[model samples]
Target: MKIALLSYSTKPRGGVVHTLALAEALAAAGEDVTVWTLGRGGDSGFFRPVDPAVRQEIVPFPDVRGEAVGPRILRSIDTLRAAFDPAGYDVVHAQDCISANAVSRCVRTVHHVDHFTTPELIACHERAIREPFAHVCVSAAVADELRQGWGIRADVIPNGVDSQRFELAAQDVPGLSRWRSRLGRYVLSVGGIEPRKGTLDLLEAFALLRKSEPEMRLVIAGGETLFDYRDYRTRFDARAAELGVEPVVLGPVHHDELPTLVAAASVFAFPSNKEGFGLAAMEALAAGVPVVTRDLPVLREVFGTVARFATEPAGFAAQLRAACADPGSRQAAGRDLAAGYSWDRAAARHVVLYRGLLG
Candidate 1:
């Protein structure tokens, strides 16, 4: 079967990571899979190397300075729509709002629903949810959201983790030494300083956390996005200064070094207000690291047994303290939990869905 999996950017955002991994897994399962994406920032390929079996279509997406977010979103839709042809593929799956809007017919994986205020964005978000031929969500909670909010039924397919890679990184003495030497005993968070990420909350939590354990540091990594959040970033910087906490902001860590970075952390923080599935937390789990995430239904569904959930900054601070002091049994349990969510399993389920739709 010929399959085309579409996503908005080649950056290492959660959805793009899902897109590439799913494409490779589908190809591994003997399906002809092609990954179509807008190569934002003049990039020509994915953040990391993909298997050669799967075809790639990276449409050039150059940046326009001072372009407003609304106009940029519209242009993204227009550019991708003009370049993408949906004739040959048996299944066309859009992995994000932009890609979903670009295609008229598709199975959209609504990773997470956003409450947009802008007119164009609000319309785009609405159409992306309403117009898809079918829908898939990574968790039952998100699926329930689709049913309740949009009256749409969506299939639930959980994301898969690269468990072996992360697990092995935990054992790499030299690599762990490198990260440990650079950033000693840190609480690591991926997904940059954005409002939804609750980075300010994390900063507050880290500040409170530091009161007790002054030796441990707060480190944030991996922030690649199509949207501009300069205002949020400005707020984050000001707040960090106000809190008097210096967080090591290592933007966009390399794919090769990520596993080791995840493993070397004293704790992994995921204080997001919204999430479909916490893939980064899952990867940290795969690395045998303890996770502390915001208490949300979707997070509870995915990480209930494997992680520590917190309500607010104080809760997060407390949980971080506990996780670092005694990570407890969550380490072993987390790795096992992550190991269960295999990309092969996710791919097989996707294949079944595609076959059912095609038949």
Candidate 2:
């Protein structure tokens, strides 16, 4: 079968990651697959190299200085719609709201539902959910949300991890030594300082944690997004100052270096207010790092006993302390759980769904 998997950007966000991985897995299964995306900021390729068997179509998108978020989103949809041609594909799958809006008739994977107050975003989110010929969700909790909100039924397919890559990083003595030398023992969090990521909550928790573990540092990495979060970022900075804590913010770490970084973390923090599937937390598990995440139904479903869960800043601080005190048992359990999710299995299920749709 010939298929097109569409996403909004070539960045390292969760949905983009899913698109690339699923495309490679489909190609490995002897199906012809192509990934279509807007190359925002002149990005000619993805954050990491893709397999040669999978084709890529990157549409050039220049930056519009001083443009608002709503306008940028509308322009993104228009730019992708103008460049994409759907005539030669057997199935077209959109991985985010922008791609779903760009394409005519396609299948959409609702990774998570967002609550928006802006007029453009509200309309865009609604159309993307209601107009797709079929829907897919990465977790049953998210699928159930769609069913409750729009009366739409969706197939639930869990995300697959590149477990071996991280597993190998855990054993890289030189790499671990290098990071440990530079950062000392630290708590690591990916996904930047955004509101939805609960960055302020994590900052507060880190301050509380320092009372017990004075030498521990907070390291944040990998934050690239289309939306404007300047206001939220300003508030985050102010809060950090008031709490007298400084965090090392590494924006967009190299793809090759990520595994080593994750593996070297004393613990991984995933305090997001909202999530579809906790992919970053799962990667930390693959690296055999103990994980402490927000207590949500979706995360509880995904991590179960493999991770430590907490609700607020105080709770997060307590959980992080406990996990650091003893991580051996959870680390082993997390590795086992991470190894069970495979890209090959996810691809096989997707192929079945596509065939059923065609029939």
Candidate 3:
């Protein structure tokens, strides 16, 4: 089957990572898959490198503007492109909320919701999630939010990672010792510097933890934020300096190197206020690193009994301390849980969904 994916902002973030993994998996399973996106920096920065098998077609358009032409009109233009060229593909999958609204009726459609927290985005998403396209939610919590808040029914398909790549290595790298020495032995947090991700809360928790475990260090990995919030990285660094604790900030590590980063951690710290599905937490679990996340429904569902849940920063710090104290049991439990998921299994499920939609 020939499939086309519509990605409005296909950047190197969680959602884009999920999309590419799924696309690659689908191609490996013998489906011809291609990605249609507004090229680099057109809408949102397109940072991810595309797979060789998965074709990428950048839509021909200038930089997106303010509400002068309006988003609806821009969406209509994207829809026109799909409608005009409906010859090659049997199905079109839209990975973006707004872009899904414009797919042609000739092609079977699928829409995956990575995360939808705002009411305005939800309302806009509702228009795209019509009868022809099957709606897929990254987590049950996300699905419930769509139903309860937006009344949009969707199939729950958790976001998947390439487990093999993230698996624990038999031998550690020669440079790992130096890397760890520089990073220190504290809890690790990896994600963009954003307020919604609870980076500030993580720093606060780390500060609280340092009082007891003075040697503990908190390492953050990711780039600076575009949105004006608390300047999470800055705030975190300042707080660490104020407390006289070691805080390591390693800007965005490569996808291939993520396993090393996770494996080196004493414990993986995720204090996000919300998530569609905690992909980073899953990666940590896949790497046999125990997780400490907020008591959110999506995270609870993903981690199950394999992680430590905390509601506040103090509790988070306590959990981190406990997790660090018992690394062997935590790693063992995480490894066992991660064994349940593989890229091939996730690919097979996507194939089934696509075939069912065609039938």
Candidate 1 C-alpha lDDT tens digits along 1-359: 99999999988899999999999999999999999999888999999999999999999999998999999999999999999999999999999999999999999999998998999999999999999999999999999999999899999999999999999999999999999999999999999988889999999999999999999999999888777889999988999899888889999999999999999999999999989999999999999899999999999999877899998899999999999999756888998899999999999999999999999
Q: How far is 197's C-alpha from truth in model 1 (Å)?
A: 0.6
Give candidate 2 misplaced runs (Cα > 4 Å). none
Q: By TM-score, how accurate is candidate 1?
A: 0.99
Off by over 4 Å in 1: none
Q: Model 3: per-residue lDDT, tens digit, 208-316? A: 8888888877788865332344455578667767867666777777755667777778899999887877778887887777899999888888888899999888999
lDDT of 2 by residue, 1-359 (tens): 99999999999999999999999999999999999999999999999999999999999999989999999999999999999999999999999999999998999999999998899999999999999999999999999999999999999999999999999999999999988998999999999989899999999999999999999999999889998889998998899999888898998999999999999999999999999999999999999999999999999999998899999899999999998999787887899999999999999999999999999
Candidate 3 colliding pairs, count: 1
Ranking by TM-score: 2, 1, 3
In model 2, the clashing pairs are none
Model 2 lDDT on a 0 to 1 scale: 0.95
Alpha-carbon error at 188 in model 2, in Å? 0.6
lDDT at 54, model 1 = 92
Error of 3 at 266 (Å): 1.0
> Cα RMSD for candidate 2?
0.6
**Model 2 residue 348 CA deviation in Å:** 0.3
Candidate 3 RMSD computed on C-alpha atoms after optimal superposition onto the true structure:
4.2
